[model samples]
Target: MRAVTANALCAGQTRPGSGGRTRVLRLLLTLCALTALFAPATPARAADTTPAQAADTAPPSQAAYFADRLRENPVYVTDQLPREVPRATAPDFARIAKKTGVPTYVLVLPMQSSTGGKELLGAVHDRLGRDGLYVLIEGTDVAQATAYGVRAPADAAATVALYELPYDAGPLRSFERFAEVIAQGGEKAADRAEAARAKSEDDEPAEMYIGPSDRSNQSLLTGTLLTGVPLLIMLSAGYVRRRRRRSGAERRLPRWVVPGTAALTATAIALTAPVVFDQTRSSAARTPSPADLSARVERVAAGLKQDPVYADPESPRVLDARQVDRLHDRIRDFRRSDGGGPVYVSLVPQTPESESAGDPDLFAAAVHAKVGVDGVYVVADPADGTIDVYNHGLRLDSNHLFLDLPDSVAYGDSKADRADDHLLGERLDALMTFLDETPRTDRPGSESAPAPAPRAADEHTLPPLFATDFWPGLFVGAFLALLLSGIAAGLTWIVGALLRRRSATPQSPASAPASASASVSASNLRRTAHAELTSLIGEFTEPSNDEPDDHGEHGRAWDCLDAAMLLVEGDPGRTRERDTDPATLVTVIVLARAGRAALAGEATEQCCGVNPLHGPAVGRRHVRVSREGNRRRMLPVCDPCRDTAVAEPGGIPDRLLKLPGLESGGSRLPYYEATDGPLSAVPDGIARLIDKVRETAGVH
Candidate 1:
């Protein structure tokens, strides 16, 4: 009609004569004004309809439809139901209801309606307006029943039926079990229920019902084992090393000991980890709190800001590419329409954190608060094909939409009606159409909607990604074990090296001075002492055939050489501990030199004051040694050392043996300055050397 009016106005304006155009235009304007005045306003929404009128006009709800059907037959079974409810099982249900001796109404549907099974049962009972037992068996393995003015133990019968039948038992079998309890009176059913409860109690593992205190105790124990085992292994190794060190043995563990112990600790922790993290304890109803909700809302809001359709792939319910394209197109169409701000269609799952918070309106409000934009939000739980629609800027009444929409699209249809993917798309389309029809209430972003109240705080904290999972935990533990093993091995190597050096050198109460040259290998010194002792022994062994009275001196010389050899070569037969210390080796050399003097008839008591390993002293000199501070002492020295000391009056020569400190590890000093044994005492007399060899060789 508007097009014809427009064409008529245009044709009138094109008239050749000015006078004719003026008349035609005035007439066309008058016709257009009449047409505008006569057009009616857009149709009234159902919200505006009176309750009586709405009741007269609105189609029957599923609960009412089922109730109406139950008026004709006691057993109502849909052609399509959950696998747990076998097909064509209406007769079996009817038979069970007849045996109960009272009117029993059973409704078996494939899935739950928008209203839950309990609510449906109540609604159906009210609508039927009869006294009987009402039962509803729906998909998702839910069963609900109630009795109105009936004498049956509903709770006991239900409990008995649930406990007696397997979870996967067909609805007919469950109903039969339920009927059996009803046929037997309340007392009998109660008894059966109690026995079934006892059996279930026996079947349940005690670990399943572990309390918070018990769980905490278990966690504490597990943590202790995880950390304490490794620490204990390290402590044990240290203890073993300490005992050996005190026993005059090497203070180091074997190469594989530390690492092997660490590996065993990690293995024990890994094997027992399941006790702490019981995945079976995780409840499906575990929902996220308000803090967790904020993150998910913000993520969706951010995505929606970029693209209207937020299809989360990680969600249990993911939209296919085709469904995404369709949703995207629908959103574009919504935006192009009047009163449209933005259309956000989210295909996200009912995550554990948000599972119990299934209110799409709450989710929509949260997304809007985050997005800071007025829009139509559609949140779908693809797991069960449940979709929710919320309008922020538009004047759409959600109650009216519910009233107007078909049962199949409004409440997701049964699996037989449509596949989940198509069902979601169809619901979205219905919401869009409803949004287009509703009048505008407010402008987009003009006023902000309040955010939804967050869920209560949950007792359990959300586990970090892969934190409690067996494989991931094991992988992390193994990696940690490897790291600990490397550290242990490295420490073992460093400690072993320090101990070997400490054992190989001499240990004394006093520290070695800086001037000592203790770098000479103790083994080399022992070999040299061994050679000298052997030569001296051979010399004394000749027995001097020309003088038999020379036996006493020769016997003394042989005794000193034999004792010196014992000091150089440790008594491996008695104890494996080597006696070839650097200071001990120096003492052995002194002994050998003293024995040589005994053989030559020019026996001298003193050796070099600077280094006894330089052989026996020939004379004495007044020189300042670093070990004696500024005091000058007449120290006995060898011929070469004496010559050097006399030539350089300012300082002593640098031929002192720098042995390890007599106080602790890593410290060093001159042998004569630090040691109080053969090296220090022998410069005054060969008596200390003789006693040391005699004691070491077990000689009187």
Candidate 2:
């Protein structure tokens, strides 16, 4: 059977090995085939080419071509002739004309000489008749000569220009070219002239191109309707849509999303609010009627002249009637031309003293009146001879008036010449004449309409609803909610865990049967309690008494008492008689003697006890006693001790009595009996005796 089993095992192993080898060989062959199939093909090599040959065949880059073309040209310079004579004469012109085969033309320009002299009298008339070269003399300054590049000698009297015109040029073209040469230098003359002409054409003031009144109105209406209505509607719709979307989103999302969404909504509202506010403001600023404007202007004009307007306390100054009239005219003209808008006027006073205050002669004044009125109105800075014309409650311009007085009147300390008075009189007469010509009108009551109180900033309309307080409150609430929920969940989990552990725990086997197990457990508990009590006694004992006294009585007594108590109390089934046999009694007596010896500070015998065989028998009882001198003070014994019927009375017996045992009776009590005498009458009398000895000996 072993051989058969061995053969079967060998067959199984051999078959698996042979089959595995065959599979491995197949896999290797397949891998080799795959590797061959997937191998990369070799790349074809490229033909070599030289840099120079390649560059020659390749097209030039745009930048390189441009550079080559730029390098092929040489720089050229040309000079142009002037059309007019220079303020000073030119000496290089002749040499230049001869070298270039261009005839020279001389132009003599006039000058304002400090010495009175006649103007130029055809000084180059003979030279102008030349066919190829013409000399033209015209009044010119240094600017004209400089413009033509005509360099003249410092002492020369005239400038000369040489021209070479094309043969087919007409007179007009010739003159135009001549002017061109005078305007710019030779090479760029034609280009400069063309540029200047184009610029002039471009710069020419365009006529106010107003469409037909009806057509303009219609176009404006259409544009306003198309743009304004759609824009307003779109903006309003966008605002509503955004607000609604944000509100919906806020309701759906968590608290954190609300702040950012509210911010965005507020920004949108803020942006659109300005446009609405501006529309209202513009409506408020619309121009009043022309009649109202004219009346306002007249009232403002009247206020300007006799209002005793004060310019400054140090220097007395007021607007003259002429200035007021001029201001009225400017206002009327502006109203007629520009409709109604805000205008600013400046009054320039010429006074040496006023000029010294670091203040300019120009003083600005404003009037909130309308245009096309003759009356004077008192406006800002009415003390100065500055009258501001206003159109539609907006300032237009200021009319300034300068004071003119006789030199004697202005500067009384200085001598006055007749010529000075004539000049002053002429100025004053002009002023008075202007004042006389000024038209007057009644003051308009509506002109002084108080400006509406400025509206408060819109932001202060209501306390910010979306204040920092709002978000923080929400955040705190949410955080508190989350925190409370987490705490509750944690508490629940802990309670559940504790409950599970409590449920899973098994009861301790009903504490076994209280006979053998309980006795043993009780004995162990008593031992532990005795040990703890002994330790407490030790702790209470003085450190100075670590070594036993000369008698060693207290230490010996304590040791005996502890041992005896441990034996009696530690055994739950033992009767008290056995606990206090004769040997035990002798030990307690000896302990009492030891205690007396310790109190007397003398040596005494150390008390000792041991268990013995049967002796006197007595019933179980508790006894207690107190020690006095060498005797114990006993307490009353239990009834069980006196009752002869009770077995083991007092739970101890006298040591001299014999018991029915095989061995001779020892000088100790039987295990189950009590003591017979009144000495053992008290309950726990021996224990009480030991305790009294311990207390007297100060052994705790």
Top candidate, metric TM-score: 1
**Per-residue lDDT tens digits of candidate 1, residues 1-700?**
9787687774554456688777878888788677666654323343244344645533355567787789988887553221223334567678878988888898876444344667778878898899988887664222787889888887788887777765535456667788889889989999999999888876731322333444454554455556556765765576556544432232234768887887787677757666445543322122333343355577778888888887653222344444555667777887887666577877765432352245566767777778887777777765566666666665455555545655665566566245635467667777677667765644332224445443333333333222334344344444565566567767877997796577556322111122223245544555655655555666665465654332465655665666665665543221112454557666766666667767776566666777665656777877755433565667787776777677764345345555532322433244565665556666565766677657655777
Q: Give the runs in model 1 whose Cα sits over 4 Å from its true position.
A: 1-54, 66-133, 136-144, 147-153, 159-188, 194-224, 247-255, 275-281, 284-700
What shift in Å separates residue 286 of candidate 2 from its native position after superposition?
35
* Weakest lDDT window of 10 consecutive positions for candidate 1: 507-516
* Every candidate's CA RMSD: 21.9, 50.0
TM values, all candidates: 0.32, 0.15
Give the C-alpha lDDT of model 2: 0.31
**Full-model lDDT, candidate 1:** 0.60
* Clashes within 3 Å, all models in order: 14, 54
Model 2 per-residue lDDT tens digits across residues 1-700: 9666544443443334587786765565566566556654321111122334445543343223322322341110110001122111233333233332333333322221211212111212221222333322222221122111233221111121112332222222333344435434353554544554555555642322222332334333333333333334434444444443422211123444444554555456545533432221211111222232233224333433323222221111233333434444544453344323222332222221121111222112122222233332322321222222222222222222123322332232233232322232223334333333333223211233334322322211322323324344444544454555456556866996797477445221111111101011223333333343343244334326566543354564455445434434533233224333332333333333333333334533211111111111133323311111222222232233324214532222221122222221322332223333222222343344455434444556
lDDT of 1 at 323: 50
As a whole number from 0 to 100, the lDDT of residue 109 in candidate 2 is: 22
TM-score of 2: 0.15
